[model samples]
Target: MIALQIIARLLDYPDEALWAHRDDLLSALADSQALDEENAAKLSAFIKPFCAAELLDRQAEYCSLFDRGRATSLLLFEHVHGESRDRGQAMVDLLDQYRAAGLVLDSKELPDYLPLYLEYLASLPLEEARSGLVDIAPILALLAARIAQRDSHYAVLFELLLAISGVALNSADVAEKLQQESRDDTPQALDAVWEEEQIKFLSEQGCASAEETAHSQRFAGAVAPQYINLDAHFESGTAGESRP
Candidate 1:
């Protein structure tokens, strides 16, 4: 759980405060039994570059990598639903689940933001957290592959996430999915993606619809049935709440 929390923190935009505690955080992670030596080393390796860099430089890199494009966006639904109505509905559903569990988001972040999602998972019991991780494994795999293609150190974080969930990454499948869904984030491409008319393939062939349905079904099956009692977590004040 602490490892998850640390990963969540690392994924967030770097800042002076975070930099101040960098060593302490790495030490805790290195000593955590939840992570084996290899994973701990991978995490350390991922953090080391950013840690050695100036905070401002790291912040700029974060913005460039995650905020400048949809390809490596940290928002989960961006990959699955794009700018479609289904994405809106998925956000609402996820927010409802968070509220039901008494987990409130004070920030303006959407429910599908990966760091926020990871924080939520860190709050759950280990089994529930692992199940939650497995539910989002596809998205994680896609992001990991995309980051790895760019040779970014952040790929390790996603790899560790998949490892934690016991999910194997299918590199070929991830590559195909990325090729189909990922678009350049240039102004022209953004306009095309946000155009009034839905793309013919996504709308007519129901690619988005089918994928959304599958993701929804998988998420619902993972959380709703087994964790319905999480609602009671609200009343009992036991469910943990996190903020970005």
Candidate 2:
């Protein structure tokens, strides 16, 4: 559905490519008949000012909201599987599913990046896409509540996604959870997180002292990136094949 495609692009980084096509994106949402009157109006209200703002401002806002903490991470799996071996395997499994659906990714994006996942869903039948959203409705709902707590315009997008999913989710439950949760994106919280993470890494890696941790850091080599290379399959001479 065009609404899915539009939202897929909308969730992506606010680069010039998306900015340049803002008018077309709005036009498609209206012409697609995929959204009802209220959703369309809410989305339009968000997109109008979002697109009208200066590019630098938009980029900064995006980074502030999503890049600062794991709370608003756009990686779908990050919310589900944080620093676990199962997450790695799940990503590969998802990549396989994408290939089976003729959704070979052309970029370096992870298989579970929410925007890319939405793009994959956009290529499916409307009901199937809705089902896909429903599969992750709880995540979307928590995201909606969390972003709403931040008083961000992006909450509308999550709310729209949940609305589209048509799931029987409880917004009140999510809000209650949010009420009891402390903010993780604050500078103090981030620093504490890094310190705790270092301690955890040292313990997990058998570093018995600060000296061993320091030595390990001094000798640390290039760390492998955490990504399932979606481009690997195309290396078999099908790189130029059109995506679904």
Candidate 3:
């Protein structure tokens, strides 16, 4: 719902109000006449993933918004790592509070930070860390540094992320059939069980069912999103109204 609210605000708010304060814009959107439960739920479900990414990306966009040196430093760190909280928080603090701390390093010194970044990566959940492996060379490079720096945990984590991301992207035939094991007999050995669970949930929910709505006319393009929107029904929506 938050994503939907943001999209709605972006759509209806005045241009001057667009990039002002996110909190203020969110509040104004909640208060606006355009917002409603159904549309809001749809919007939120669509934008949730991108919103999370955007919140972090914005810090990288504006230097003076935080300590410029630290902000840029954190981005490079994040490109090769992950952490408990969104890395964007560190970027925000660096650019905003330490913008001119006189700590800019030479481009060559960038490699020196790989160990620190790998330590941060190893501290994260494997699935979380793999999300940063979009550019695997830097990730592998950081993993090598981590191994030499007495932080080999990240090397393992980096490999797991790569294996999982690869399985998700390339091994769809095996991924779709969870009944069949990939390299091991156990279900845990399967790389895509997590993704399969989602597909299973959709199948169970009749998302692909051709059954018509018993009352209102069933529309096209209503199945899969409706399944996703089920999660978006929080404390406020048609589904939430049933909660006592």
Compare the candidates by lDDT and give the number of the best one.
2
All candidates in order of lDDT, best leading: 2, 1, 3
Best by TM-score: 2
In angstroms, the error of model 3 at 124 is 1.7
**What's the lDDT for candidate 3?**
0.33
Tens digits of per-residue lDDT, candidate 3, 85-170, equal 65556555534422343333343423224333333333345554334233233333333233323322223323333343332221
Q: Tens-digit lDDT track for model 2 on 129-181?
A: 88788666667777777788888999889888877876555344467656656
| Candidate 1 lDDT over residue span 1-244, tens digit each | 8889989999988988999999888777865666788888888887777798999888987887788657788998886777889989899999987887789899788899999999898888887788788667667767787777766788889889977876544333455444434334456554544442344445566666666555444433221110011122222331242211
RMSD values for the candidates in order, in angstroms, are: 11.6, 10.3, 23.8
* Each model's lDDT: 0.71, 0.76, 0.33
Q: After best superposition, candidate 2 residue 141: deviation in angstroms? A: 0.2
Candidate 1 C-alpha error for residue 122, in Å: 0.3
- As for lDDT, the candidate ahead, 2 or 3, is 2
TM-scores for the candidates: 0.72, 0.82, 0.17
Q: Clashing residue pairs in candidate 3, if any?
A: 4-43, 4-44, 66-95, 66-96, 67-94, 67-95, 67-96, 67-99
